[model samples]
Target: MHLQVRIDIQRRRQFIQIATFGVLLIVHQHHTGQADPDDHRLRVFYPRRPKAHRITEHMDRHLIVVSDVIEPEVEHVLSAGLSAFNDQMTGINDRQSLAVTVRNPDTHQVLGGITGRTSLGLLFLDLFYLPESLRGSGLGSRLLNAYEEEGRRRGCRSAVLYTLSFQAPQFYEKHGWQRFGEVPCDPPGTSRVFMSKAL
Candidate 1:
């Protein structure tokens, strides 16, 4: 029982740390983009928890590593931790996998499709891909529509996604998705466009 309590407390601290970091990054980004310091006001979300102390203590016990390759084990750990915290915070632990796959009719091999999830009344589109030969054949739109329809069936009220500037922004716009923000990224003049739609 004592160990469980300790684990719960640690998860809460980690949640607070992650939330605070996001708030700080937004504030810093806004401030940095402005030509004058006073042009934008810096707002902070101060959690009741001892954020500095808790973060320091937590960081001291953990090993931080940077890598270029995909690590499924690391992803699982982070996802599990965040899911627990989200469940505790909102009291809604409904995270359903949403996907629309394109498979070879002959071999039943999955080629490309859309992958996403719906949680807390929101649908998140994480990735979407289709072969070059399949583009402009109306299959992409069909797959996207199917994904969104399933999200609605799963009780999601809104959907969010990010696409590269050179990618399918116009396609999404034509299908009722609106741009909310854009952040410049690599390859020069390219950016990641964040979009959303009300289901």
Candidate 2:
């Protein structure tokens, strides 16, 4: 009879232990579920993009508009200063700085501006800035062709430039430039796309 009582106690203790474990598991699951009602953290997908050879793009020319704060000032200043400095080095102080300005043929008002440069025997069609309304017009194409002609005259073998992933990659591709490398941007998930074409 004592043996039977001890067996009963042991079975009862096992049952209590199992029940306690089940209750704890239920409470843990309930708390976890309550903490995140909308489970958005569990879903992510990474797609593979084409990889290409890495190239450190070197730029030698630029354009600047100091008065226009709405524009990219530092880029303009850097480009202008570099061009001026390079010209001074070559003993050619003439206004070789090419700033392509488009005007409305009817109103005679300036539409936009584009800048070009020659670096290390290569003409670089670096900076092209046009207002929104002027886009889709043939002005960009005209400016590019003119810039290439200038580059040819300057004896540059190639032209290179960079654009952000959010910007006009398709446009550059359409214009016979090929993508070479991309640098991932920090703090934001973006990339700088570099492209070049033989002149």
Candidate 3:
């Protein structure tokens, strides 16, 4: 009888330990917004459902604005969505980006730079910036030329970029880039000009 009692106690202890572990696991999942491995659906945990619903309703009613903060994960999701759409539309996904920087030789401080991607036989200049001190000093031209040369080496035939009306449209034109399109934008009279050049 004692042996049988001891066996029953052991079974009860094991069951309790497993039950406690299961509860803890569920609690952890609830707190961390982690879903079960078998569940492929995305999950987000909120402390209160009412608040979450209010926020969702606000987003549905208004233009979502998250003040000036850069959310890298959100950006990654957006980029991934576009890339997936592009891949679906075109079987060729040969897009590759390159960044070029100019720095002070002595201080190694970055002075100016350009970044863009090459795809579909074209180089898309996404971002280009040179300090006011370096503008019109021939450094901008050298940097632009070097980037185009690199793009040519990478099999890009044409290059395209955009600049605001108040920005470097004339600078790009002076570098042999031809204005191809203009998009009217905010603040009324201003526009964004698209330019391109054969590499």
Candidate 4:
């Protein structure tokens, strides 16, 4: 009985030592921002929640605007989120941007052009612009045709774009792009018209 009691005491001391060590290790990890591999609760209790909150607040307070400032780190984070979402939805996320530029041969100044991307069998025409001087000279048609050809070469089956009602909705229509929908803008007689064309 004495031997058993001594063994019980030793067992209780060992358990207390283990518990104390575990607590110390957890506290050390928490202080150092190092996660304990065996403890999933450490991540939850230590940095993940607070880090997530910080990220949420940072994102909430910031607005992404069209500007000259280039933030590569912020862009990478946003692009990663989009890529992950695209991957989850389609099981494939391949986005390749194509730019067609018209430049003066003598001065090498870029006048205007088209910029777009082909992803998941669809071409997204993000930007298309031409100078007023070059508008009626068939350059726009040539650029549009060249962009669509490149999209087809990249395995895109259809193309999509949006033009303001006051902008080149008629130009797209002239090029066989059919209007799919439109959203009215703030000012009267203006709307964002969505158009699509099959390759």
lDDT of 1 by residue, 1-199 (tens): 1111011122112222223333321111122333443332223333222322322223534633334555798789989999999999999888988879999999989989999899999999999999999998999999999999999999989999999999999999999999999999999999999999999
Which has the higher lDDT value, candidate number 2 or candidate number 3?
Answer: 3
Off by over 4 Å in 3: 1-70, 186-188
Q: Hey, what RMSD does candidate 3 come out at? A: 13.1
Per-residue C-alpha lDDT of model 2 across residues 64-101, encoded as one tens digit per residue:
21232434766799879987887888976433455667
Residue 67 miss distance in model 3 (angstroms): 7.9
Ranking by TM-score: 1, 4, 3, 2
Instruction: Give all TM-scores, in the order shown.
Output: 0.66, 0.49, 0.61, 0.63
Please identify model 1 stretches exceeding 4 Å from their true place: 1-63, 69-73
lDDT of each candidate versus the true structure: 0.74, 0.60, 0.70, 0.72
TM-score: the better of candidates 3 and 4: 4
TM-score of 4: 0.63
What order do you get sorting by lDDT, best first?
A: 1, 4, 3, 2
| Clashing residue pairs for model 1 | none
**What does the lDDT read for residue 196 in candidate 3?**
98
- Model 2: runs farther than 4 Å from truth? 1-96, 106-108
What residue pairs are clashing in model 3?
A: none
TM-score of 2: 0.49
